[model samples]
Target: MHPITTVHYLALSAALLLIGTVGVLTRRNIVIILMSIELILNAVNINLITFSRIWHNMDGQIFAIFVITDAVAEAAVGLGILIALFRNKETVLADEIDLLKW
Candidate 1:
């Protein structure tokens, strides 16, 4: 088998990005949208790590670590908000939880 290359990594990242975008755009569930956002973040991490490997540098890895941290924080906060919304509205659907609408 051919050794894995940056091109392969890029293809994988592209696929993830596509799927995440579709998920976010088409799904109405708030939880699904959050998951799709995480997928997009993961795709970014893959690209950063792949480039770091190609360049033989630590910068990409460092940035990837930061991205991971950010993703974690975002997930925590998002889930907290989702839980609150569910408790108040009794629904997780994006269209149903229109708290912002006046």
Candidate 2:
């Protein structure tokens, strides 16, 4: 059996990261931004796992696990912020929020 090439994983991760970035930059909805952030986190995990496989080391895997944990925490915190914003503004649009005004 042939060992997997690292390029495949890197390419996929890049694609996911690009999509997430585009979503973050283009989307007006706060919820979508949070989801885009999650997408970026998942792309980071893919990169870590791929490097781990290429090097035959556990360190990358360990880092991937940490990234996953961080992603979860970030999601929770981001959602909480979105909820608070929605409560105050009555909308989820990024343009609708004015933290400096309040």
lDDT of each: 0.94, 0.89
How do the residues 1-102 of candidate 2 rate in per-residue lDDT, one tens digit apiece?
Answer: 876578878988999999999999999998898899889989999999988887899999999999999989988998898888778779988877666774
Give per-residue CA lDDT, model 1, range 1-102, as digits (tens): 999889999999999999999999999998999999999999999999999999999999999999999999999999999899888889989888665766
Local error of candidate 1 at residue 76 (angstroms): 0.6
Query: Model 2: runs farther than 4 Å from truth?
Result: 1-4, 99-102
Extract clashing residue pairs from model 1.
none
Report the Cα lDDT for candidate 2: 0.89
RMSD, one per candidate, in order: 1.4, 2.7
